[model samples]
Target: MADDIREMSFEQAIAELEQVVGQLDSGDVPLERSIDLYDRGAKLKAHCEVKLREAEEKVEQITLDAKGQPTGTRPAEGM
Candidate 1:
């Protein structure tokens, strides 16, 4: 489920969030709907944050070590 959510584009995430907000605002949905919306919203928020972090890391030219783990060093500075 998380992997599927992560595959969604930013636009898709925003669209889903809008739907969630609408459902929450309507106050007509059952408890299950509210819970589902809340869960989806949480996932969307996390996905957006991850994407933003990755973009920032890329712009900063961050690189990973041989094991594909971040070296914890900034770009243009030796690891």
Candidate 2:
């Protein structure tokens, strides 16, 4: 993955991935370009998965009080 891709937010990565999928599905890109797009799409998908995992971990960190109110976030487990 390029450094630029690593710096992209999840939304940006997902948008580009969707565009790449659309282009590949259309079957109009030349073979070389299709290969490049597929590679980029794979990287974008991985990045998105990592972002989602981070989000899920954060969600799991929410500390609840006796009344089930959110008190604060605890450290992510097994970090």
Candidate 3:
């Protein structure tokens, strides 16, 4: 259900998405079943994107000196 989807971690969502892709690609599912799987795939894809965007927003890049030592960290974007 939707509640279960929300609880899935990024890795879990991606794993399920991969399984869905494999099933869809196999072309062995009944039309109705395939439709259902496709819908779930869409939701999983959206969830994964949201997780990635959240991680991206929190990402920071380490500033290094000419000697290749990490000096500090700064936001990965919008600096």
Candidate 4:
């Protein structure tokens, strides 16, 4: 589970998180399983956040020329 979760792409993490939310929302999961799902959900949420922040930083670092076209990328700062 550790390797699999850590390796999941952003999309995969998000989709699994949504499914975990659905199961928890339905109130049909056993208490024990719900607790386990909640833990996984927390990890997934953190992973998603990290992925989003990395993407945001990349977007921020795009160097633009006078015409506002992307010239290239700059080094991301304050990472």
Estimate the TM-score of every prediction. Answer: 0.65, 0.77, 0.84, 0.75
Candidate with the greatest TM-score versus the true structure: 3
- For every candidate structure, what is the RMSD over all alpha carbons to the true structure, in angstroms? 8.8, 2.9, 2.4, 3.0
Local distance difference test scores for all models: 0.78, 0.91, 0.94, 0.90
Worst 10 residues of 4 by lDDT: 53-62
Decoy 1 TM-score against native: 0.65
Candidate 2 per-residue lDDT, tens place, 1-79, comes to: 7898899999999999999999999999999999999999999999999998888677658799999999988777774
Off by over 4 Å in 2: 61-79
Per residue, candidate 4 scores C-alpha lDDT tens digits across 1-79 of: 4677889999999999999999999999999999999999999999999898888777658799999999988877775
Ranking by TM-score: 3, 2, 4, 1
Candidate 2: pairs in clash: none
lDDT order, best first, reads: 3, 2, 4, 1
On a 0 to 100 scale, what is the lDDT of residue 37 in model 1?
Answer: 86
**How many backbone clashes can be found in candidate 1?**
0
Error of 3 at 16 (Å): 0.5
Which candidate do you rate higher for lDDT, 1 or 2? 2
Candidate 4 at residue 41, lDDT? 95
Each model's backbone clash number: 0, 0, 0, 0
